[model samples]
Target: MVAEAQNLKVSVWRGTGETGEFETFDVPSRESQTVLDVVSWIQQQADPTLTYRFACRVGMCGSCAMMVNGIPRWTCRTHVKKVSENNTLRIEPLRNMPVIKDLVADMDPFFDKWVSAEALHHPTSTRNDAITPVDATTPERQAADAGIECINCGICYAACDTVAGNPDYLGPAALQRAWTLLNDAKDGGRIAILDAVSGSGGCHNCHSMGSCTRYCPNELDPMSAIAGLKRETFRHALRRKRDA
Candidate 1:
């Protein structure tokens, strides 16, 4: 038994998919320790076979996102002091994703939705064509700028309740990316992109619960982007009806 003052009681999910069980560990408490540091310590000092993922420890790379105390966060940036309750921490793989192993959630489905949303930019000009000068101050550019900082971390995807309940939902990150591309003046796939997200499983499925925005490490507002897509798709539908 660990003395309550010197050690942290950490309960970590240990298995694949829904078959996991929480394995508790008592780790020595330290000042200014990040959650990623704690996991690294566990893997290094306590258990060597523990599976997890991390790249840049400084939080630039979004590869270290995990569920800390029931909330999705970039583990590298999450200080243990800020989240631990009574010197206890609960660490697990991100929610709404298939667990490949302990702390490593498969991101294929999350990215698949990105592809389904047609979030990639389709350039209007060929390489040989002159570069199109875009005014950064334009409303479209500003809208695009607001959402272009996403690092594909999957934190927003994990926090989305729509993704949890609706398998077909395109999700906040993907929809937000689509919105950025939609506003890009040089993107040529606007029609297809709009069509992709206009489906029943797309932006319209969002409940605007703001979970994505609330948990995003990059401070992006995916909810606002989804709202924009909703408005744009509605206008497109109205135009289609008039043209019919």
Candidate 2:
């Protein structure tokens, strides 16, 4: 595999609860090898005590995200050659979250942010009522569909400095979901959702660092999503002011 002679020196974190060290391992590099493959090799060949979290080796699960070379990414899809620095790699837990152990960062807060964002849909029509049809090609739905493929990997949140600075900020993923729901013409909670994201710790809090968009694996622009939220919130505020 991969010429079987060269060695890759990798430094990985080990342990949990604020007690851990960067353990080094040497493994043979291979063609088209991903970062997850290298880490699995270390656990099987080098140290059995290594701790991490991974459900699927593919990118769909979004469970294998971590800090690769100080950038948040899905390790399962990340290639060794793409992230390795001078034949070495430093892997750690994702930022802005609790480290469970080694590379497994706790995702509880990340999910909670989703709940706080109120990104869920609330149907106004009863089940007995006539079904309403929506055109998928509409401008609003099309804009919503552009960034709707997010896998909730938390990479955007980890890469966001606004989330790191203000714990109350809903972060990009949740806001992206909110955008999707808000654009749905049939959703009854549009005004409520606007109210939710327009207040303190809302869209105005974003500093536009663009790290979330820069590091997204799916090529989404959460920065743009946040800007859109700002505009919508301002429009809603002006409407309220005029009504008052």
Candidate 3:
């Protein structure tokens, strides 16, 4: 809770199709104020037409992620005092994405790259096959477990410098998911995933800026996952050469 109530000067982006402008609002501060709360107040009181997206205000869902003061974060958990300065804030949609409206960025491109990276697991056996139990203590499981908590909020993607520069780059989340599936004992698509990530705009293009890991809301290390992909892809190339 704030020591005293004061009006916060907030600058919010309002536009469509990658083109937009900022609208300033003076919102009354409250106890334990959150950025999402300010946005909600603006929509419900100051301007009913304000556009934004949010679900599960407790931060379980990543839908409320946005750029606050030039950094991507989950607005539901971002306290206004933490990110704001002098009772002022500049809010916008997540970067490296097409703006759908005032605060909604089109996420289709991010998800599409995820598919292209073969992030989904391919089961080695059908349901008819007997259940194959996995040993959680194994090194493979440990590696895979490290990255399975990703919620696809696209925060890492928005923080990726490569994705910001090259539209074709696979980004961090997709590669991290692929690395997780590759380490899964029952997945059968290791080779396919490796091949997919080794192609153009794949893991090789990653500049290792570390922003993905630095900005991940869940504290997942996407940069390490990408590094693992690089090592495994190299090993795959060597095996192919040896076989040939």
Candidate 4:
């Protein structure tokens, strides 16, 4: 259908928060043109006041993530030809977050969840202490390695249904970060981190629907990380009961 068309019909959200409407624009299509390119064209050619966010054009930064035709994706990496249907495209801000403006969701809440989950590493040894060597072959190291690549793109957060149902939910990325820290051998706050993620609105709230894993751009399995948190929390609960 798009083969015969010289221009693509793109509908982009135009407002702040939930008060937006889709504004249609006819974008000229080109070979290898990406969704970001379409949005940039609309802003530059059609309307100069249109607002959006993007940093690295390459896929490494994950700064160009947005909802492309109802799916969260890195616009910098998503080619318009692949996602557009019949030469039509719909672009919107990521869901389940406060939108600051068109295509720019406030990332404060997402990062706040990371802090609430205690996702930061707590060092066990001081710099004055002897250097410690970590064995990469160990299972704990492997587990930590599995989730260490997340760039906080928030794609998985937007894809999570639990976050939609429960605003207080920690979401996948935060919980995945907690799991990575939990497996870290030199981390001093294992028990405290476990306590943080095990409470209400934490890992227990995840429905394990696998939406987070399904939309993760990095191909990381956050569902597996959440499952790991569930098991570790259960073990901790059991140990506390036995100790009591």
Candidate 5:
């Protein structure tokens, strides 16, 4: 029991995979406390057995992302006072992901989906060839630059309702990557990438709810990228029909 009246009530999910319960903790409240600080205190003072992931306590690394009050946020940067209501906070592992432990979500499936979307860069020229100069003034280069800042943070994936309902959806991040690569002048996998995204679980599967863009900590508009893919794939389809 909290001996003082100025304590924060925290409910954290504790379980592996899909099975577990929310364990409540009473943490002393402070003026400048972040949610990460509360979690660290719980592990050190409350329960040493508690498990969570964090690095670079700043916002640079997104490893500290978790569901705080049903929204995915980087715990390292999120202030406790800003998100807490009535000094009560409910924390859980990221949704739409399999929990490996108390606060760790398995990221293999997310990356696998990324690969399925053909988000990787495929070179157009051999390494021995001269470096190709890309002009930033071009629309293609600008499009790629807009989303190149993504560091594979799963926050957007967790925020996407399409991913939650459709097991086959390629996801916003993956599709956004595909759009970036499609706009790259040096990318040689345009046809394959287009073909992959044009099929089932592709860009069309998106409902355009914009949840991914709305919750992105980086403020990237993945919805716009997906929209670009829709237009590109439509034009690609028309060209194929015209040639046939």
Candidate 6:
């Protein structure tokens, strides 16, 4: 199908530091067009000074996540045809993050939360041990695979209401990462990682809104990953109590 290219009334957020507004522009829309394409058109034709962030135009990098029409979405995949109601688009930076510029959000806290959740892998098995292989289709790997495709895009973090309410909350991405590591048979940091995320602003804070799952471009279920965390933490806590 030859998609029609219509004129779109676009609104791009401008400026930062407590002063910003949606500057309107006339953008050309086309068939199979994405929100990123619209923003790129504006940057190319309407205003060269408009600042936004995007690395890979594809959905892998997760750097193109933003607030599109009041919802967090990966601009690379969000089709304007589906989201635009009246040939109008409102683009803004992701929520709950510091705006470095117009549509660019600071992601320092997002990365820091991964560390806070102890999401990193530590070696447990020695090289001298017999080599072990993992079956990809096994229930354990499948469970870990549920949330394994995260590009660290922070869409889940920004969309999460719990993260907005509590600045210290580890958020879905971090918690999901922690869950994956916890399930990894080779990871030595499982116990410590669980302890880290079991504290204040951890998995317990998740409200089960599933905003992370809803907003995930990769379709990973973060809520399920978090639920797994809660279960594991509770089980481990009880085991410790029994030993005490």
Q: Which pairs of residues have clashing backbones in candidate 3?
A: none
Considering TM-score, where higher is better, how would the candidates rank from best to worst? 3, 1, 4, 5, 2, 6
Q: lDDT tens string, model 3, 48-126? A: 9999999999877789999999999999999998999899999999999999899999999999999999998798888
Clashes of 1: 0
lDDT of 5 by residue, 1-244 (tens): 3244589999999988889999999999977788999999999999998899988998877788899999998888889989999999999988898999998898788889888989998888888999889999998999999987886778989999999999788898899999899989888889989998988899999989999999888889999999999999999999999999
Tens-digit lDDT string for candidate 2 (1-244): 5455678999998878788888888888888888999888888888877877788888888888999889998999999999999889999999999888888899998888776777887697998988877789998888788778889999999999998889888899888888888887777788878877876867789999999899998898888888888899898889899999
Whose lDDT is higher: candidate 2's or candidate 6's? Answer: 6
Native-to-model Cα distance after best TM-score fit, residue 197 in candidate 2, in Å: 1.2
TM-scores for every candidate against the unseen true structure: 0.96, 0.94, 0.97, 0.96, 0.95, 0.94
What value does the lDDT take at residue 31 in candidate 2? 88
Once superposed on the true structure, which residue ranges of model 4 sit more than 4 Å away at CA? Answer: 1-5
Tens digits of per-residue lDDT, candidate 6, 94-172, equal 9989888899999999999999999988787788987567678887788887778889999999999998989999999
Q: What lDDT, from 0 to 1, does candidate 4 have?
A: 0.91
Query: Could you tell me how far off, in angstroms, the CA of residue 165 lies in candidate 2 after the best superposition?
Result: 2.0
Model 2 segments more than 4 A misplaced = none
lDDT values for all models: 0.93, 0.86, 0.93, 0.91, 0.90, 0.89
Would you list the clashing residue pairs of candidate 2?
Answer: none
Alpha carbon deviation, residue 135, candidate 2 (Å): 1.0
Tens digits of per-residue lDDT for model 1, 186-208: 88899999999999898999999
- State residue 157's C-alpha deviation in candidate 6, in Å: 1.0
Mark the 10 consecutive residues where model 4 has the least summed lDDT.
1-10
Cα lDDT tens digits for candidate 4, 71-185: 9998999999899998899999998989999999899999999999999988888989976678899998999999999988899999999999999999999999999989888
Once fitted onto the true fold, the runs of candidate 1 whose alpha carbons sit more than 4 angstroms away are 1-5
